[model samples]
Target chain A: MKVITIVLQIGFLYVFYITGSLLQRLFHLPIPGSIIGLFLLFIVLLLKVFPATWIETGSAFLLDYLSLLFVPATTGVMNYFDLFAGHTIWLFIITMISTLIVMIFSGHTSRLLARYREKRREGTECQQSLSESSL
Target chain B: MSTVLIGIVFISLTVFIYLFMTRLYHRFYIPFLIPALTSTVAVVFLLIIMEVSYDTYMIGGQWIDALLGPAIVALAYPLYNQRHLLLKNLYPILGGVVVGSLTGIFSGLLLAQSLGFNEKLLFSLLPKSVTTPVAMQIADGVGGLPALSVLFVMTAGFTGVVVGPYILYWFRLDSPLAKGMAFGSASHAIGTAKAIEYGDYTTSVSSVAMTLSAIACSVFGSLVVLVFYA
Candidate 1:
């Protein structure tokens, strides 16, 4: 019974994916159907159209083995060895450098924004305390 | 081997290898020893040594591949769960992901171009920071090889997981939100897994950032492709 429930939940997730594909074709959107499905599911959840429990177990199971699902696609790189043959080192350097840059850029950007928000909150709290003391 | 037999053998082989690699990763706790990276290398090596062509391996591999779409859709659950936190810190998360996604796309393009990479390779590398499926889709739309884009995405993911922590510490990006944003925007899901070590809040924020970054990358990536390729 437990296995069947999980299977059915996964099947339910697939329904969203099919709907996304259909919408993509109908709208001629540039976005992928899977992504469209993701947005659709997110919206449905946000609106409380269905309880989260409906897909909880299924999503958990899939997220657990998410890395495993990537193996086949990653392995597809075998057929394209020629593309990386002469440029392996350059590719490595570029990816590493760009990744580092992005991490730092995004990290610092959020950190600064978070700090600013924290300071603003603290300032408001301080003002409220001051006003209360005066009263 | 018959088609059915090949599919069963390769699918089982991949599962077995992934399980073994997961065990190894848990034991060593090394950043580079991630199951995804190690198992993929192991499977590719096995296929090559057995004189098996990629097509035959894919015959079985496609079964697993078919699950990727739904798995991606399943990402919505985490994003949904984190809705409260996402709403509370909307500005920081949105600001960080937007900056990160644009930087990821443009920087990759500039670096690849500077290195004299060919047009096909350059476009393939454009979506490197996105999660695999979205990256592959964007790559295809932009005249790049989707398979090759996967390779670049894996590289970017591994690099982020391996190096991201040190950079975060070195720069004192100590906030949970900042750490999560950095990993998710720069490296996608692999980095999100790494974010688990930090704590639950970090993990939640990371998953949220990962999803938003994918959307942001898709938009920015498409625009870049259009401006240059069209």
Candidate 2:
């Protein structure tokens, strides 16, 4: 019974994916269909069009094994050995350096922005309390 | 082997290897021993040793690959769950992901070009920071090799899981929001997994970051391609 529910829920999600693909083709969208499906589902959830429980179990199951699903595609690298042969070290360097740059830049940027927000909130709270006491 | 049997065998083999790798990862808890990386290497080498052509392997592999689209849609659940937190911290999260996505694209293109890589390789490197499925799509759209883009995405993911924490600590980015945004924007799903160590709030923030970064890159990435390749 539980297995059937999960299967049905997954089927429901697949419907969204198909619809997204159709929309992409009809409209000539540059974005991937799966992404459009994701956005549609997100909008549906946000609008309370359906209860979250309907797809909860199935989405959880799929997300848990998400990395596993990537295996076949990742393994496709086997077919592209020639392109990667001379560039292995350079590829690693570029990915590593870029990864570091992104991590640092985003991390610090958010942290500073968050701190700025926090300080502003505190300042407003302090002003409110002072005004209330004066009143 | 018959086509039906080959499909079943390959699917089972991939699943079994993934399960075994997961167990090994949990036992050792090493960053580099991630199941995705290990199982992929294992399966690839197995195919090479058995002299099995990729086409033959895909007889089953394609079945598994077909699920990737649906799985991507499943990402919406987490995004939904994190909506409250995402809305509350909209500025920081949005600001961080946008900047990060641009940095990923520009830095990757500049470095790769300076190193004298060809146009195809540059396009492949452009979407390396986004999650694999979307990155593959963007790469295909931009005249890059989708398969090679996966390699770059995996490398970025691995690099983040391994080195991201140290960078965060060195920079004293103690806020959960900062930590989550860093991992998700830089590394996608793999980085989100690492963010789990910081607790649930960080995990939620990281997942949101991952999704937003994907959306940002997909939109901005094409514009970057138009500027360069067009």
Candidate 3:
């Protein structure tokens, strides 16, 4: 099962990679593979093709250690001290302002959409439960 | 014997300093950004002021660097857990990546170009808005150096961590899923790390979002390179 889990994850990531490549190759759209892989998994789950337990353990294991990914890049910053000396002001100013914009807009938009969906779901569930009780 | 002894001592000290700091980060500094962020900031300053070459500092930093690849492989969980919601909201998530990556890259590239930056600088800055690994690959894939990519990625991560929360709050981003997705989509893992600070659900969602964003940004970034620069 552990080996199965590893195989599944690698397989899924490749699926994401391939799907992302094909999307760009065929449609010239700006979509990414990870997102596509996510979607593929989403579809499989919704259709009951794969059970929840199948991916749960492996997925959790990955999240536990994900932060370590940035260490190499962060540590590598030691190499570019001069680069910063030249561009600290530019880098600081640009990174701060632009990242703020990206996060705020993206986060806000998704939240609003989620809100709409949650409300819709609750309303439907309420209606169903009420109808069943009445019958 | 003396040189080897010094090298061993130096290795131990780096390990001690990093572990101590990491413990502090996990404990006392739980709510705030990790000490690693401050350490990153401090190290950058030390390198320039001390006139120490980046390569010299990397000698010690390499101990920490070795863990990065496995961390990336670990991002499988959050994606796995949210498989159902991910399916339910697949279209929107896909739409989010498309709009987000394009807007980020074009605006970023155009601004740099308009500012009269050269191609080398442009290559470095182009991947600045994404996560570390994918950003490095995209940078290398386009004529930029990996060293430059790492620098840009840290800057982006720092920027994302500082700014992501305020934006979420101001926008009243109350959903864990959206919060995670936004952070993941924008900053990659660093942003997701911050999102995790908000709660478990936020962390998980943001992580999946981050991985997806990396995969998206890479493909889109490469395609852009091939189309225009190639």
Candidate 4:
């Protein structure tokens, strides 16, 4: 019974994926079918058409095994070995440099904005309390 | 052998090795060691030693590959769980991810282009900041190699795992929201894994950032391709 429920829940996810696949084909969207399916599932959840419990087991199962699913792609890296032979140094340099720059800039930018918002919220709260005290 | 039999045995071998390495990493608690890196290294070496062709390995590998789509679709569950937090911090999350993704895309592109890298390589590197599944999809959409893009994504994730925490520390950025967003947007899953070490709140926030970044990078990547490349 438990296994059957998990299977049915997974089936629910696939239904969304099929819808996404069909939408992608019909519309020629650049988005992947899976992503469109993700959006559809999100909207379905948001609307309370189905509660989280309905899919939690299957979702948890898939996510727990997420890294395992990616093993194939990592091995696919071997296919590009010849391509990297002449450009190994360049690939390494570009990947490291770009990654560093992105991490630093994004980290700084997000922290800066979050702080700014936080300070502004405090200010608004202080003003509200001041007004309330005066009243 | 039969191809089907080879595929079965090969997959079992890969999973066994991967699980073993994961346990080893957890037990040792090595600061820089990541299971994906170690497992990939181990599997590649084992395959080479065994003379198992990439074709044969993929015969089993493809079973894992097929799950990528549903896994991505399942991502929506996390996003849905965080809907309230997302609504509350909408502006900051949106602002941060947009800037972070643009930084990721442009920095990689300009650097590679300046180095005179070819178009295929440039496109592969373009989606390095997004999660692997979406990154691969974007790479294919933009006429790049999907496999290569996954490599770049992994590299970026590793980079984040190695350097991400130190950068946040040096800057004294203690906000959980900021830390999570930075890690998720810039490094994808690897960064999120690091964020998980921070605490539960950070993990939830990073999940939000990772999901949003994937969506942003995809939409933004296609637009760049449509407008600039085409």
Score candidate 3 by DockQ. 0.26
Candidate 4 docking classification:
medium
Give TM-scores for every candidate, taking all chains together and pairing residue i with residue i: 0.91, 0.90, 0.69, 0.87
- For B70-161, candidate 2 gives per-residue lDDT tens digits of 87788788778878877888898888999999999999999989989889888988889988878988899888888788888988987898
Interface RMSD per candidate: 1.8, 2.0, 4.7, 2.2
**Clash pairs of candidate 2?**
none
Ten-residue stretch with the least lDDT total in model 4 chain B: B195-204
For residues A75-115, could you state the per-residue lDDT of candidate 1 as single tens digits? 87788777666755687679888988998998888888878
Candidate 3 accuracy as TM-score: 0.69
Tens digit per residue, CA lDDT, model 1, B1-230: 68999999999999999999999988998877878789989999999999999899999999998887887788788778877877888899889998898888888889889888888888888888988878887888888988877888888888888778778889888888888988888888778767767766786678777878888887888898889867
Worst 10 residues of 2 chain B by lDDT: B192-201
Off by over 4 Å in 3: A1-69, A86-92, A116-135, B1-15, B19-33, B42-63, B223-230
Query: DockQ, in order, for the candidates?
Result: 0.71, 0.68, 0.26, 0.59
> Alpha carbon lDDT of residue A65, candidate 2?
81
Q: Can you tell me the CAPRI class of model 2?
A: medium
Judged by DockQ cut-offs, is candidate 1 incorrect, acceptable, medium or high?
medium
Output the worst ten-in-a-row residue range by lDDT, candidate 1 chain A: A83-92
Between candidates 1 and 3, which one is better according to TM-score?
A: 1
